[model samples]
Target: MDTAPKRILLIDMDDILRRTLAEQLSAQDGLRPFPVASGEEALAHLAMHGADAALLDATLAAQGLIPALRAGGLSGPLLLLLPVGMGVPIGGDDHLTKPIRLGTLLTRLKALLNQTDTQSASAGMDDILSLGPYRFLPAAKRLETLDGTRIRLTEKETQILNHLCRRGGTAPREDILDGVWGYGAGINTHTLETHIYRLRRKLAAGQPLVMRIEGGYRLATAPVPA
Candidate 1:
């Protein structure tokens, strides 16, 4: 049986680029690209049907669409496509500067998806991990609120939560980085902190579920019902 292809959201204003990339992605097995011309349309589509990953144009990054997408419930890994000499750093999981080779793009996309796939498989069954008023299913990369709203989690977010859950609701910073990112001790990067901030914004709302400890972070053990 053929499994469904991974869905990739492609947002680019350039018609030629969008069509060309979409065709290239479609030609590859196990991949599907849904192209959109504007951030508004992309946001709408994401709200209704989320994708596995998103490829956004640099113009959208300039317009600060990354935060908007996160606020609008896009929890996938985002990759920004930049034109030559676009030096501004974008808030995304990754970025590629044009002129990009299709093979390079495919390799990057597959790496991102494979990372998530490995973690998801290791997450085991769709068991719910409760944190305060939120319930998270690591395998599904999903979180459910007490009010019944469902929020999807980015792959990294899910991995972080799973790591904390396995460590009795609290874990050291170094341990988290090593477990979730496969980074060696003493590796320095703000990426983990950034993802934590975004996850708190999405999952916590007014009530915080993740708390900072002396040398790490902790998840609330008792369920704080809404």
Candidate 2:
């Protein structure tokens, strides 16, 4: 018997579009796509229930809907399923013009979950990121405390942590916004701080892993707990 697919959240209004996308993603290894109709319910689950990634329709009529959802703390790579005559959003990680092609959707979705790492979507960016005294395994989405407790992190939390780690102690606000959040411009890293707070709380302060600094934030070498 095969194992269950990784949980994914699909936020789209159209029933047909939702089902079709879910079916295609279901075929991938360790990839499960959960379907939701409205933006509210979709975001609610993301904050409370959690998802590996999110797919949103650019045509959502609710004003300020995308930004609102993001402000509510969306850290995962977001793909805007574009609408007729509408271009992609400035802050969205990626986008695709829609005609409901399965192959293309899978390719895009895979890329969203896996960034820059070309081998396999499951091959997370983890091995590449190191913050404080810990090396983050992005592929596994797990953070190992200095004391050796392996704490699982959500996709966005991992992404935020990766940006901090990749900084090598000089994490620039602009770079973090563009690199981690996928915004090429309008770089605001205060959002990054919010995420770091939650992560620090989970990992604990005495751990001495993450910290703030001038000119943005920096991930420094931290000592493991004694």
Candidate 3:
């Protein structure tokens, strides 16, 4: 069995509810919750750090977080927490009303993660891709060197590298943004550049792994000896 913990994004305006859910979820062996208090914070976090699943409060519907999440290219399972007497909305993959049972929540999350893993395997995305001397595992969001040194990758860094790898190790700027951030060609955001800069810093000791071409980025494709 894969022992990797699934990262869950927990969003709620109620401080007590957010803290409680975060604590309970973290106590689970295979779950880790990244809690945020408001829709804005949630959106920002999701934009930079993708989650395996999300738990959102229905109260944030007024803030339009659901639509924003889609626009931000978060393709993970979403669970909406509704207030008492509230009807379920059409957006989330699953939902639970207020006064939620922790056991039920855990079951739902585990099911969702299992479904995602099966889908990923069927799609042939479970294999690791080689990047020079490093091994890049997209589904696991992990990078490791030939010497067995593991390197931590932020969500954005992993997404960027994965996109580049899929595109034959090179992708134009607009195409990369579209693939990774779901942003259109004309939309301007420095977020991609910032992530690339930081990622380069993290990979500094590795061979010139990521490089900027005329219009975008590419990974070093030269074969590495096993």
lDDT of 3 by residue, 1-226 (tens): 7777888989998999899999999898988899999877877888898777899998786457787876776667777899998865545655678888998788666765665565455432566777778888767667889889987664456667777776778899999776655556886666567777777777888776788889888887732222
List the candidate 2 regions with Cα displacement exceeding 4 Å. 1-5, 116-226
Q: In terms of lDDT, which candidate is strongest?
A: 1
Expressed as tens digits, the lDDT of each residue in 1-226 for candidate 1 is 3378988999999899999999999999999999999999998998898888889998887898888887887666777899898854445765678887998788667766765666666644266767766777776677887888888776677788887887778899989877765556797666578878887778555467778889899986742222
lDDT of each: 0.77, 0.64, 0.75
Candidate 1, run of 10 with poorest lDDT: 117-126
Highest TM-score model number: 1
> Which scores greater on lDDT, model 2 or model 3?
3
Which 10 consecutive positions of candidate 3 have the poorest summed lDDT? 115-124
After superposition, candidate 1 runs with Cα above 4 Å error? 88-90, 124-226
* Full ranking by TM-score: 1, 3, 2
Deviation from native of the Cα of residue 24 in model 3, angstroms: 0.7
TM-score of each: 0.58, 0.50, 0.53
